[model samples]
Target: MGQVPDLPIRNFEVAGQGPAPPVILVRSMHNLLNDAAQRALRYLDELDARSVAPSAEAVAGLSRFQEPLPETSMEPRDVLALLDQIGSPATVATAGSRFFGFVTGGVLPATLAANWLAAAWDQNASMVVLSPVGAALEDVVLAWLRQLFHLPAGSGGALVTGGTMANFTGIAAARHALLNGVGWDVEAQGLFGAPPITVIVGEEVHVSMLKALGLAGLGRERVVRVPADSQGRMRADKLPKLAGPTLICTQAGNVNSGAFDPVGEICARAHEAGAWVHVDGAFGLWAAAARERKHLVEGVELADSWATDCHKWLNVPHDSGIALVRDEQHLVGAIRSTAAYLVHGEQREPHHHTPEASRRARGIEVWAALRSLGRSGLEDMIERTCRHASRFAQGLRAAGYEILNNVVLNQVLVSFGDDETTRRVIAAIQQDGTCWCGGTVWHGRAVMRISVSSWATRDEDVDRSLAAMIRCARSLGVVKNNS
Candidate 1:
């Protein structure tokens, strides 16, 4: 390696003005970051006292961002001040305990701090040479994930943005493995003349998996749909006869019902028919880490590949997904890039297993989360969230509402009454601002979907949110006073 020389700094002064020296940007960045940290801490501290949903006034203030771009650079501190003034109030408090919408998890303090540090480091985690720390952290994180999920010892994994990309990455590996089995080089020749691969999915399969299929050159609507039971579990026996180049996608957790398919039976049948099995575990995959709920994901390790989102259950920041393949070569073959300038090391190169050459260092936060929450801590969070979910279901049912799904996991679906009433209650709850929950149509009936995925959620938070929900329903005249 050659030694690099330092560049000379040029100083500029206005005509007839005093001498002006070169300015150091580092001090300004430090002050800006310090201000940002203080503002963020203040916001987090106020989450418990503030409304989970943004206020009307705060929402109306969003027009402040519509201003035209400035021709000149503004002071960083002033920019940060403006963002906090306008943007902070308008944001939904999804990181709060009462936020039960969209299966989003609050950030673990350790992971949040790690994200900040990683941002400061700004490492492109494509290869070991690019960022030794990032690559090493990724290796450790992948191992921890494998052991936590009870996946195969040698399984290769990649950290992605979220569940969708995770699904895409895993399915891409499946595509490569199935195509290679029949002497077709999918990477080299593409899917042009490649043998048509059959994709099997449950009737209630999530849209993300279908999007992954479409991205992989497999038509989304072309999959063989196996019917699901009333509880949303895929009927394993209803699966069609499997044939050549087949890929079976199974769900570990249903979006609405929080039910698991008979993955043991499905995996057995798929493997017997020489098919590959991929699991879209998403939030539900964390159940395997909890001793009480591990049975929900029984036999998931048998799947050829699995995709999961750390942001959902691991309580990490947004955009952390894992793609795991039982065989390393399959994932590498599907996503690896080759370039003469690229350096290959003895250690793992993350870009070889993932879909992108340049990506954020998501594994750093994953490693921080795992380190902060050991096996027992992780299990406790999962179990506690499920317990809160069950409480919601019990409270809603006791209030003369219909509890639609079995509270097997951290999802509760409640139907207030008819579709119209249910929609009204949902709208009212959103407007009430005591807490936030989303609406979903489950089994052809309008229902409120509450996902208790945050570690911040407590029993008191659940009780408070439940009280608000009942009040909203009662005000709508849906729940009788007697009931």
Candidate 2:
């Protein structure tokens, strides 16, 4: 009773008068996007005018996630202020012409705009009825992607979270088919006390594959590790004679040097042994679409299932990956679920092809990205990235750095002087912020891993990065000491 006497109530007559209608929300979003686009264009103009790299603190801060918010709405101006408070790192610049960091992509206008629309619509792409336009876009995008990779007709495609999930879906399908061949209903019974299935993979396989194995109930350490060449390509001739239900995991592109395994031979050996072949092509699979690099993935079409990322080579924004299976039944059998209450009817459902129930409209961005670039434009992007990688390797080699691995696709691995020098150069390069590259232990030596993949990158950017690398190497006393 102590201070509750002044509580006032609104009249029922004023209850129906709302501040704004739902249509205003839509209009507000449209206006916000238009304003953002105009601002971004102006910022881009300014960024392109500058030659020096921005401060590391400034660039790296962009990745910081904002604080958790209360379950409430704020004023639009307040939200904009929050966005301005956050700073992003140079990774977005890695998508720009000047950055040569990990494989990253600039936001293509069409993809960016489509993603905005997708969020606005907030469509769940689990089934056609959930969002007919999203479902249809996925269908068209999958068809075009299949054709681009030269995959055979009738192959099933799924838009997943990213390459890891893509690999998971592809391997799941492979597991289903391989285990089913031996009379094991994995999906029904789970991996508890099931017949052990053999999984053979190249030593150079990406870490995501191992993660996928764990997720699929196939033990990572249990898989047979095949030997790889100096360039990290799997030795197809060394395929161990195998019996029983088995799965052969091959690489379409080595994550280190972008080298591809002997897909034809590997597929033939797996087929001969009655094993399922799954290719983890996260970025390399798209090389087949580029005429110049198509030979790198010569035998990719023979793969039983494959995984690739739109955010990587395809240059779509984050969180877009595709999994393709040669057999539709295998994909459906692997991921489909049943529930009496939520009957999906006798129609093709998106959930059956993916390991998701209520998923986002990821295909909209992919469709927009592909349609914006078209086939030729995409091939050009791949070819140009490869060329830039070669340029980087050549430039580094000329500057006295030990170029490791063959400049096969778009990955270039190099070392300066000995292990210590290489480590120092990598640290200096990162701290210097002229460009950003990653480090990896390759062939017992720590080396710099440079991946060229942005659509915005050009010859000048490659040259500038190479020059910066040379300067760092020289300053570390490595070039003269080695000479």
Candidate 3:
């Protein structure tokens, strides 16, 4: 690193009276973008070949970016150069096929391209007047998602940051609708003196759903926790007597076991009691696309509200979530606001349906991904990921490991032996880094959680990852070297 360089002064005038059109930025921007794209392409090209986790040296190299703020602005090209050289290597290859530490969906090619293009456009999606394309894409993707998820025919939704926010938005709508039914407008009058709303959740309800409940002013601990069966499905028989203004939160997929709750049963029970039902599908809601997995979440469309993440199962770039409500008015009533400067047109304003006032048009990448991968392509992707998960379970179980969960969907939990040995095996597998899997406590046992979540994953990738896992376990004396 050397002395920071000062940027040259740039001035631009009105359209007819400018001294000269600024060409320096145009030239520099072209060069910088080209450089960035090339570097990105190279990173993606080498993604699978490298370790899923970054090397220690690369992590140590991040110290280079910790310098004090510069007194003078550096050239854009120099800034990008420093970032690309230093930042790229330290990233975990979640975009690659083998990284499975979380429910991370690898960005598809079309979605990646759309993300870059959307960034360049830099449109605020708060209002349709700001970006017609953004609002239009949001409208399109919402319908496509509702249909694909088997949601209500005319349900409305918002494209938010991710699953947490998606859950927040959906739960907010449930609060509004339920409170309104009891002649108390929670959104308008606040929850201070409102009717007490009864909230119910499954025993294995996702943390995000609880966070959403708290955010919506429904006390997380105040909810009735329904008991769950062995596979983490909410026991429909265990649901408390539904009474008063109630909101029942069901799970589409259990985070640990990937099992689904009896959503249809809960929906029936709640509807009979005039209670609103919400589902936190997160990644499992995508199972609707495949007939094989669809049976797991049968009658999902009957729910009053649903929330999911595009970044998890749709293979889109991160931080995209979809929140859908069967009744459009409830979603709009709960999330919309009026401001003099906010000129909302006839078209659906993206912000009104979400929590944020200003947000990037996430629907652009979602639209691009769905358009590129049509009905058959999406179905194939989900089915393929489940098949890969089954393969992992088979390989690990065949090698004398105890699988903690039923191989139902794209999530598998395996134990190497006892808790200590399982922990050691997990640590060793991560250190070996042929592929990446996370650890979780399932059924009071420590187990390695493997989530097959990317379209890039194939038979060969699963085989290679399985081999690495068994090799690491064997090296740790957790598995016999019989294979």
Strongest candidate by TM-score: 3
Estimate, for each residue in 65-96, the C-alpha lDDT of model 1 and write its tens digit.
89898887766678889999999999899888
Preferred candidate (TM-score higher): 1 or 3: 3
Q: Write the per-residue lDDT of candidate 3 for residues 1-483, one digit (tens) a residue.
A: 232233343565568897556665555566667777888999999997898888899999999999998888876777878988888889999999998777889999999999999999998988898889999999899889888887777898899999999999999999889999989888879999998999999989899988888888897799899989999999999998988999989888888889999888888889999999999999999999898888988978899999999999999998899999999899999999988988967777777788898899999999999999998999999999999999999998889888888989999999998999999999888888789999989878999999989989989999999999999999988754376
Cα lDDT tens digits for candidate 2, 312-427: 88877788899999998999999988787654756568988989889999899899988988999899999998999999988888777778888978899998867888889988
lDDT of each: 0.91, 0.82, 0.89
Least accurate 10 contiguous residues by lDDT in model 2 = 1-10
Error of 2 at 312 (Å): 0.2
Give the TM-score of each candidate: 0.95, 0.90, 0.96
List candidate 3 segments past 4 Å from native: 1-9, 12-19
2 versus 3: better lDDT goes to: 3
Q: For model 1, which pairs clash? A: none
- Quickly count the clashes in candidate 2: 6
List of clashing residue pairs for candidate 3: none
Q: Report, for all candidates in order, the number of backbone clashes.
A: 0, 6, 0
What's the true lDDT of residue 345 in model 3? Answer: 72
Cα lDDT of candidate 3 equals 0.89
